[model samples]
Target: MARGRKLDIEFCGFGDGWEADNKEKPESGPKETLPPPQHCLVMQREKRRGKPVTLAGEFFLSKEEEKALLGRVKKMLGCGGTLKEGWLEVQGDKAVALRHTLEAEGFRFKK
Candidate 1:
């Protein structure tokens, strides 16, 4: 062996004609069922110039469901909000009031 030299190696034991065989597979097995999804509303408040002026509301919902939910929250809070990247951005610090509204609408939420 030479110093700082590498040797070329080759593997030749495994069969080259290997193939997966599922001919005698069962007709069916136990079906895999996923757990029920959870619906949680998350609200956060961000401060600007030492004053809270923006509230971010995020709800886990499908794309179609998010539009309606965002509109409802914005109207209820009497504030401007937009849906972006699957999140609702309400312009103003309305975390406290928003939590109350969500709870009244049968939604479980967290800060």
Candidate 2:
């Protein structure tokens, strides 16, 4: 039981010594676990205007990650590229070169 102002009510156990005995036990729950690391990378080629354009097929990454990867690919191939709808679109065809780079980076391409 408690009496006095709201603040006093909250601090009722103060200085009484009996307050220490009235403390409530904290509740506990299961701990969260992180997901496993991703493996394997997808590769696909798209043709536009009667020409083949090689692009990074699957792009599951944040904006910063996407930007970094796009830059790396463009620099390695000496070409221009864009990140669109979670896909990396590089100008011209560089599928073989891109595949080699991805494989060297510990990612296996699917066909």
Candidate 3:
């Protein structure tokens, strides 16, 4: 009870043989399905700093799916790209190439 002094204490009457038995793990929610081919994805080309970049949108994909798709597209195109506000931004005017690539993956595009 003194200033900065530790008190000797003992806890009892709680049964010494008690053990925790939480073994079951909680399950995660179901994964989301990507949009079907009938849903058209929108693609647009824009010029930034005198260079062209393609923006692919309207896929209605989750964040993980978008990141994975961006990775695959970047690898396939051998160029740098990023995900911005749920849209895929590839570095170049790759509208035609992106259209073919996404079409191969069963995705439709706006005419």
Q: Pick the candidate with the highest TM-score.
A: 3
Pairwise TM-score winner, candidates 1 and 2: 2
Model 1 lDDT per residue over 1-111, tens place: 888887744564336875568568773455332211344667767776676654444455555567777778888999887777545677777877777776776677553
lDDT of 3 by residue, 47-108 (tens): 98999999887666777777788888998888898987657889998888888888887788
- lDDT ranking, best first: 3, 2, 1
In each prediction, how many residue pairs overlap at the backbone (N, C-alpha, C within less than 3 A)? 0, 0, 0
Q: Which window of 10 residues has the lowest lDDT sum in candidate 2? A: 28-37
Residues 1-111, model 2: lDDT tens digits: 467635547745667656555678764444232211344456678888887777775655666666877788789889887887666787788888887766665555555
Which pairs of residues collide in candidate 1? none
Model 2 score (lDDT) = 0.67
Clashing pairs for model 2 are none
Alpha-carbon RMSD of each model: 11.6, 14.6, 9.6
Candidate 2 segments exceeding 4 Å error = 1-39
